[model samples]
Each structure stands twice: as C-alpha cells, then as structure tokens.
Target: MRHIGKLLLLTSLLTSSLAFGQITADPEERGERGAQDPLRSRTPEGNPLPFMQRLRFGGGISGLSIGNPFSIGVSPVVAYQASERAVLGVGVNYVYTRLKLYDSAGQRYNFTANQYGGRVFGMYEIVPKIIPNLYAHGELESISVQDNYSGAGLPVNRTWIASPLVGVTYSQRIGRLAGINLSALYNLNYTTSSTQVYGSPWVLRISFF
Candidate 1:
C-alpha cells in the first residue's frame, strides 16, 4: 500500500509539471508576449512589417548669400532600414553658384557654375540602447564641377571628382514613420584649392525623413 502511495505522488507531480508547461507554452500567449516587446520587429498582428514600411525618404536644402557669392543647393535621399541598427541609402546633389570676379586687367565679370553629383551612403546606430537617436554615417560621392584650373578668363569645363565623407547624425523622431536629422560630416578628399567643389571640408545638413 505504501509503494502504491509513493507511485501516485510521483505521478501527480509529473502531471502537474506537464500541465503547467502546456499553459505557459500556448501559441496565443507567446504571440501576445512577443507583441508587447518593443524590440521585437512585428506588427500589431504579430506579423513582420512589409518592405515598403521600412523605406525612408528625406532631403536637405541650403542657400547662402554673402555679397559677391550666391549659392543654393538641394540634396535628396532614399533609404532602406535594413535592420534595427542599420540603414543604407542613395542620394543626388545639385548646387548652383554665382560669383563676381575681377580679371587681371581689373575688369569685373560674373562666373556662374553648376555642380551636380550622386552618392551612396550607409549609417549605423551607435549604442542604441543608451542613445537611440545617434548614428555614424559614411558616404562615397562622385560630382561634376567646373574646372577652375582652366584659368579665370578662359572658357570653363566640367570634370568629375570623387569625395569620401564620414560623420555623425542626430535624429529626432516625429512619430513612427517620420523624423528630423542633423548631420555634421567631413570630406576626406577635400582640397584647399580652386579645383575643389566645396569651399569647406565640414558639411552640415538638416533633413527630414
């Protein structure tokens, strides 16, 4: 009789454990738990978000007027969120500049130029758990600019130049799908000469996404 009682106690403990596991392992319960997790990449229905939902579009515009020189530029970008921590994009650039110059003979003239380019870029989140809005950025660009080496009075020609840039971005989310970003970047291939398209190595951009 004692042996039968011991067997019954062991069977009861095993059955209780199996029942508890079944309760905890229900698919609906697990799905609800996963949906509540902020880090999980899922929709309200516990389905993965579509590709179009992960795409981001943004651009920046700039204008400068300082006496003899006037400049305006636009840069537009289309990006894809590859993961929670990474983004990849492509962009185009257009800039119009007009400058008043004095020839060697003391004659004043106007120089109008157009600079256009395209770039490929990538960004990675930096310590996202601690600072979710900060990102590290890198880009490779090829631009066409006026060949200033042709001398001040000669007819201008256009040439392609390559620029590599690295920087950081601070992004502020407006809602789930929109945000504003400020980026400060440095051009590694910048030169301090007339052939250079940009006057400065430092480039600051404010964009919307």
Candidate 2:
C-alpha cells in the first residue's frame, strides 16, 4: 500500500510540472512567430514636397537696331527648376550703346556706358502636345543705365527703367548636353520713366541637356 501511494504522488507531480512547462512556452512560441503579422511587414504612406532641379548656366549677346539708339548687350541667365511644370530664374543684362540724333551732325557720341539689371521670373507649363512642353512666364525687370557721353561730345541720354514681361517658350531635348528653346515675349511699361518703348520680340535658344 505504501509503495502505491508513493507512485501516485510521483505521477501527480509529473503532470503538474508538464502543465507548468507548457504555460511558460506559450509566450516564447508567440514571440518567435510574431514576425508573420501583416502589420509588421508594411509601412505607412504619406506625401512629400518636390525638390529643385537646375539646368545649364549660359551667357550670350543681344542687339537691337530698329529705333532709339543701336545697343548691344550681354546677358547671363541662371535657372532652378521648382518642378516638372515650373522654373525659377534670375538674369543680368548690360548694354553698350551709341545714339544717332536726327538733324544733328559732326556731333559723334561715344560711351563706355551700359545698363545693369536684375530680373526674377517664374515659368509654368500650359501645353504639352506636338512638343515636349510649352510654358509661360512673367518677370519683373529693373534696369539702370550709365550715360557715357555728355555735353559737347553728345546729348545726355535717358536711362533708368522698370517693366514687366510675359513670355511663352518651348523646349526640346536633343542629345546629352544639347537642347533648344523657342520663345516669344512682350514687355509692358509699368513706370513713367520709360522711353523708347520696346515691342514684342522672338528668340531661339540652344541648350545642352
């Protein structure tokens, strides 16, 4: 009888130990398999702002001879892309000129004078057919000219001016480091000091991609 009792107690103790072991293992097994959850495999989605894209830096010469004084100018442009449809740009232009006065002879004017100016512009894409793009931009231009000849040499010339301009442009990519721009622009007078008004002009620019 004593031996049977001892055997029964041992059996009960073994059963209790087995139950405790299973209870402790439940959490560890869940932890090892937790990576299979769908939430753990995916990330949240959100929106972000676009970044800037910069194009080429270029300098070129421009001239006009129709009216007023014949002037030649050097202009340089630096541009940064705001998005696929927009660009932010700034430019500086300097002009050297000689004015021909009607009814005045033997009075030749010479000037080392020029205009110093800065402009800020924003361009937006409006059409995208038959070409890679078509864009329109508006700009504010402030120009200050230094008259090089005065008095007995030549008559004093009018200088400082500010105006607004609207333009349309198209661009096509050629090869690496090569592209082209076709553009037209109109200048509007916003200040009283402007004389020898300028009209709309067309331009074509070649670029490198």
Candidate 3:
C-alpha cells in the first residue's frame, strides 16, 4: 500500500508537469489550440508532431516457467503515451509455484502457492538516437502468495512482496512510432520478496504508440 501511494504521487507529478508545460505559451512553438499549430504540421515546414496526435497504445510480456518443481509466471504491461518521449503503464503479474518432498519411509509431501500482483511503471526517453534509443525507467510492484498445505488445522501462510526498480533501456525503432527494447535495471528494493521466477531487475519490451 505504501508503494501504491508512492506510485500514484509520482504519476501525478509527471503528468502535471507535462500539462503545465503544454498549456504555458512558448515563444517558439504554436499553442495547443492555435491555428498555427496545424500549420507547423505541414510536411515541408512542420514542427514536431502535436502531442495528442502522437498518443500511442502498446503492451509487452515478460516471464518464465520452469519444469522441475513445476513453477510458471508471467508479467505483462499495458502502456499509454504521456509525452513525446515518456510513457506510463500498469501490469499484472502472476505465478504458480510448487515444491515436492519425501520422507525416509516412503511418504510424500507436496506444497504449492499461487502468486499474483500489480505493477505501475514509467519510461522516459533521455537520449533520442536513431537506433537504440536510450530511456530511463522506473516501476513499483506488489505481489502476494499463499502456501497450500495438506494438513487440517494448519495455519495458512501468506507473504507479500514489493519490487521497485530504476534502470535504462536501449531500443531500436521499428518505425516512426514503434520500437523493440532491451532493458537492464537495478532493483531498489532487492529483498527476498523482490526476487522473480526469471531474472530480477532485467527486462525486455516491445511497444508502439
């Protein structure tokens, strides 16, 4: 919940800053609703594209599954354009994990857990290169897992995990408005809870807007 609050506040600040910049009249750029704005969009004499006209929608997937203990998990994100080079998004994370054990006599013991969580994230392009655009990224995630036990009268065990990361992404543009990215991030909250079925703090993304 604390992480949720932090994410909301960060998102609000980012949007508010962009909004303020857009609404404030700039000496060089056309106003948002000004007729000159469209004039600037003309091919030969155009300024950069309008902000709203550049809005993009896209998503990406990340995760892995293992065979031995029968563990599987996935993390997916849905993103929206926040500015010319910035994006904000949400994600759903889910995983199924199991463990098996046997006693000396021949009895078997098995345990399982179902884990699920939510994530909020932001990405901003810091250097606009032709290929392998560089962007800064950050995200907050929360997840929970409850253990499954076979015995009656056993207390249910549940654990919650929070992951926070900040990193950089290198991407090659697919076109004017799309790209494929490979990212390397360092986890700010690197606890046992922040660990993942796949490598933690590193990610790959495909997006368009």
Worst 10 residues of 3 by lDDT: 16-25
The better candidate by lDDT, 2 or 3, is 3
lDDT of 3: 0.52
- The model with the greatest lDDT is 1
Clashes of 2: 5
Q: Pairs clashing in candidate 2?
A: 177-208, 177-209, 178-208, 178-209, 179-207
- Model 3: pairs clashing at backbone N, Cα or C within 3 Å: 56-209
Model 2 alpha-carbon drift over 4 Å, by segment:
1-55, 62-68, 102-113, 147-159, 190-209
Model 3: per-residue Cα lDDT over 93-177, one tens digit each = 6655555667899887765555788888888879653332577988887777554433423776767777676788765644344
What order do candidates take by TM-score, descending?
Answer: 1, 2, 3
- How close is each model in CA RMSD to the real structure? 23.2, 31.3, 10.9
- Across 1-209, the per-residue lDDT of candidate 2 in tens digits comes to 34334434543443232210000113333365452211111122212222221344444443232444545554566665555467667777554444555445676543234456877777787864334357786777777854443333666575777767777766553332223445555666633233322212432222211
The CA lDDT of each predicted structure is 0.63, 0.46, 0.52
Q: Could you give me the TM-score of model 3 versus the true structure?
A: 0.54
* Model 1: lDDT to the true structure: 0.63
Best by TM-score: 1
Model 1 residue runs over 4 Å out of place are: 1-47, 62-70, 102-109, 149-153, 193-196
